[model samples]
Every structure is written in C-alpha cells, then in structure tokens.
Target: MTELNILHHSSYPPESNGHGGSKRTAQVLELLVTNGYDYTSVDFDTIKALKTLKWQKKVSLFLGTLLRFPFKGKNISFKRLKRVDRLKFISKAFIAELSSIPDIYIWESTLDIHQFIAAELKAKGSKIIGIAHNLESLVPCASQFGAIVHHKSPINRFAQELETLSICDEIFVISREEQWLLNLFNIGAKYLPYYPIIETRNNLLEIRKRRALRQKNNEFLILGTVLNPPTLNGTIELIKMVSEVSPANAIIHIVGYGTERLKPHLTGYSQFQLHGGVDRSALEDILAKIDAVVLNQPYTTGSLTRIPEMLIAGIPVICNEAAARSFYNYSGVYLFSNEHELTDFLSNPMDTPLIPKEERVYTDLFIKTLKLAV
Candidate 1:
C-alpha cells in the first residue's frame, strides 16, 4: 500500500499508562507500520473517572498507568471522565488533534457514543472504520458510562445513540462472535480475524522456551490483569489457589498497573513477581518466556490478541470456563476453574502449542474495506 495517512482513534491515551485497549492499540500501531502503512494515531481519552480539567495533567496521569492496565484493571475507564461529559471532553481532543488529518480514519470504539466522530470524519471525505469492542447497551450497566448514558432515564439518550451509529462508512467486527453481535444492532461489518491484530512470530517461541528453562525454579508461571469490582479478578483468585499447593519452583509474574487495590496473597508470596510500568519490549520478552499465559476472565465478543501471541509463542494458555467456550481446538490449550485443575497442569506442561498466525487473512480484507471507504 502507498503511504496512507491512517488516523487511529482510541478511547484512552496511547502511552505507557495501564489500559488494555490502549496497549493493544499501540501494538497494532507497530503492526501497521511493519505492514507498510505510514500511520498517525489519535487517542480520544475517555473522561469517566478522570477529573483533571488540565490538559497536560490529564495526559500525564494516563501515561503513568501504561505499564499494566490491560490485564490488571477490571474496568479501564475508571481513570477517564464521566459519560455525559465525555463528548464535551472529546470535543476538546478533536480540536487539539485537528491540525493533522490523514488518508484513512480507523476508530477502535468501546462504545457507540464515540461513533459520531467517525461518521463526521467519513463525511469529510476520509475513510472511517471502527472495531466495536463492547456492545453499547451492555456497556451502560457494565461500564462507568452506564449511569452517564442512562443517568436517571434510558429514554432520553436512546435517540442520540441511534443517530451516532447510522453515520459510519464501515464498522469492522473482530470475530464471527462479534459479527453475530452486530446483527442485534443491524450494523453491517467485515469480520477480520483479530480486527486490530498485533504481529506474531516464531522467534517469540524460542524466547519463551529459553526463558522457561532459565528459571532454576520449575514451577508453572501465572500472570495477567485483575480488575476492580473484582469482575476479572480470576488471576488473583488463581494465585490464591496455586499458593495453597505450595509449589517450590513456581512463580507468579504480574504486570498489574491498574487500580492500586491490594490482594492479601500478594503480601507474603516470595515467588510472586510484580513487574509494573516496564516498556513494551521488556513486557513482550517476559511474556515470551512464561510457561502458560492466563486468561482468567469470562468471555466477551472482543477478540483477544494475546491468544494469538501466546499460540504463536508455543505457550499453553490456562483459560477459565468462560474463555474456553469462545476459543477453539483445546488440544494445546488448558482450561481450569478451580485449584485442582490448575495444580494438575502445573506438573505436566505442554510443549509447543498451536497459535493462529492469521495476518494475511485480514490484511487482504482490511485493505479492500479501506479502498471502498476511501
């Protein structure tokens, strides 16, 4: 592809602060460049929990959490602004980043409320595409935006949501699961595997293997995010169970940079390692070495890129019951719900598991969509 000005839109600061979507957004940015697309990303940070009215302070605080939000925080929007005020805040962001407009505008939306900007960009003769991570209705109750979107009355803003959804040129679905989800809204979409995919390589496999062997302690490793309201605290729960067995060689590696809520088990465990606020390469290298990647949360429609990363790295994944339902071919993947199931896998590790390297499948389709939109 020729030099394309791709405007990557996000709901969080694309910096070192701990946010999963933002981290995934950054990874995709590198992948876009590697794929020969000259791109510039525009992040419209959500303003739900964020209170700093100052622009410089808002950006600075967000960058601090960059190290561990994806896996650690249950709700990433805690640091952002409230919903009713979000668009107004984003209006400031639009004005801030307005000086630079690109050839294509790709928005990775967590909510339809942000869809208005994409539709507007498309109206301005730019290609617009969005990867919806969560259904807006579900988000209202499950998200910090829930009350804001439907504060006292869901009846009021229902019309605005529809108006926003109608304007986008094309909305991309992350998987067949998400495609089916879009049906509920009657939105047309293209299902590209890992809609915003991060690059995976075999070399990562070697790095993982070597890292595993380097550890004199032979215990299975555990690491991932633990969110607030304890919705996605599976990783913390798993550690509690694993520590019960008292394995001598095992270690728990946490990249948790989310809310500073403390778990009791973290206090006394000698094997538990908290590597927070590290750069991407350092984090990636560490992930390359772990015995098995952990996805402790229940299933959602959004595609999990780490699944591909773990698969391509030949690392087995210990996913819970919820994640197992959405993923396929468990020959190399391990599923667990309790302590007994996890302890059993720690003793017998799998060698070289399968991870789908489905880059080309989407590249062809994504380019076609861009062509049509442009």
Candidate 2:
C-alpha cells in the first residue's frame, strides 16, 4: 500500500490529562503509525498561537467565546463557538498548517465549525474523514451536555449534529453499536475498535491464575474518570449493591478522582476502598492486584474503551445487560440483570484468558478502511 499523508485534527491531545477520550485519540495515532500512514496532528492550541490582532481574529474568537458561554459549562463540545465563529477559528488555526496539504484529513470529534473545514479540504481533493467519538443525541441525562434532560430540545441538537456529520467523505465510529445508531440517520460509518489501546503484558494468564488462587474473594476494579456524573452515579450504585449482598469482605476497589463522595455511602463497608486518581503508570500496578473490572453503567454511547482493554488483559468484566448487549462477542464478560446476579458473579472467581487474535482483526479493518479512504 502507498504511504498516505494524513492531517489529524482533534481537541483532545493524547498527552492532555489521561481521560478516556484523550487516550482514544492517542491510541488512534499509534494505530495510524503502525499501519505506515504519515499523519500530522493539529489541535485548537495551534490556532491560539496564530496572530490574534490580524484581521480581527481575536475579536471573532472573543465574540465566539461569549456566544458560547451559556453552553460552556454544559460541555456540549470542545469549544461552544457558534457555527460561523467556529469556522473563523478553524480557518485561522489551519491557515499556516495547510500550506502543504495532505492526502487525508481526519477530524476526531464533530462540531458545527468542522463542516466548513471539511468542505474546503474536500474541494482540494483531500479525503475528509470524521471519527464520531459519541453520538451527541445519545449523551446521558446525567452528563454535563445532557441537553434533553435540561430542556434544551435534544431533537434539535441531534438534527444539528447529524447535519454537521453529513459533510464528511467517510465516517468512522468507535463502536458497532454507534455505527448502527448513525445508520438510522442515513449516515454510514466504519467501526474503529479501541483494542489498540490495550497493553498486553508477558505471562498475563499465568499471573491471573496465581492471583485468582491467592485471593479468596474476587476483587473488582472500577476504573476511569470517577468524577464524571455518569461514572460517579454508576460506581456508587454498584458499591452500594455489593455492600448489601456481601457484608463480610472487602472486595470492590474504586480508583479515580471524585471518590471522596463514596465516603457518605460506604458507612460500615470495609470491602470498598476508594483510591483517588493515580498516575497512568501507577494504574497498571493497581490493576495487577485486582481480579475483575466493573462497568455497570446503564446508559452509554459511542464505545466503552475500557472493555477491549480488560478483555485483552485477561480480567473478567462484571457489567450490566446494556453493555453485554453491545459487546456480546467477547468471552470474558459476565452480564447481570439485577443486583443479585452481579453480587453472585463477584462471589465466584473465574479465569479470563487473553484473545490475542483480536489485534489482527482490528488492525486489518483499520488499514483496509484507511487505505480505501486514501
């Protein structure tokens, strides 16, 4: 295959705080490199460096920020800039970088402003691909950007998001479920698995077997950004359920920021330990001690990046029916309908072997889709 030069644009840089979204961005970059594609990563930070006073660029940005202030706290998207203002922002951000145009331009998250840029690049014969991280309409009511729950008329937001996505030459979604959702809106997309993010350690299966034999009860881990509303609620609920069912042992460990809130809920429970966020490297050490990972959220969109990581690592997952419905192919995942089933699984320890074959499947799909786009 011919090596293609690609322009990658995203608000979240891999090194920027270790959130799931940023990690996904970083992992995709790695996949591109391994496949022999030459790509340039440009973020809004570049536009911030561009001359501000030239041709009222600063004024437009200021006005844009002001207009978006109402939605800023809501976390609707990267920057809440109005459509016109955002176009102005991207134009200034990319003017210097686009001097030597690449064959492909990949946008990580879709925003109203991106349409203008995608159109411009398409006119120049560059393949414009948009990676849909999440469906804007499917954001949970508990989320900061939950427009439907907050009376923002999510139908309008959904329509607007779909309209913006229509401009892309090719669409890439994080999960097969998300791709199905997009298809309903007459938008076709290819699935981009996050399996590339999983770091496989040598002798993982043997290590798991040793850990399983040593530990009398299963130790479950709830990882990711615990402070986020959706995560916070789900984690607390699972801990509460586990506490009621298993009072004699400390089995569930919560790791991430905002875990201090768990103090009020876990009054007499010694089994649940809350370790506020640790460094990325430290997280691997923490995972080494645990037997299974927990992902029991009822409502989720896009893809749960953690699922692939846990599956490939040989750690059993105790998730809800919703998650099981989407990721039914994986063998290590355990699904529960209610609190009883979840607690039952926690009481029984099991071995989860690594499915190394998934890497080739994901890599082949990624390369084939990317090559076709070029």
On lDDT, the candidate that comes out on top is 2
Candidate 2 ranges with C-alpha deviation above 4 Å: 1-3, 15-17, 47-49, 52-87, 113-115, 142-151, 198-213, 280-282, 359-362
lDDT of 2: 0.68
Candidate of highest TM-score: 2
Q: Can you write out model 1's per-residue Cα lDDT over 98-148, one digit (the tens) per residue?
A: 655566777776355565466556666776676654444432234435322
Query: Please, what is the whole-model Cα lDDT of each candidate in the order they appear?
Result: 0.57, 0.68
Poorest 10 consecutive residues by lDDT, candidate 1: 146-155
Clashes of each: 26, 1
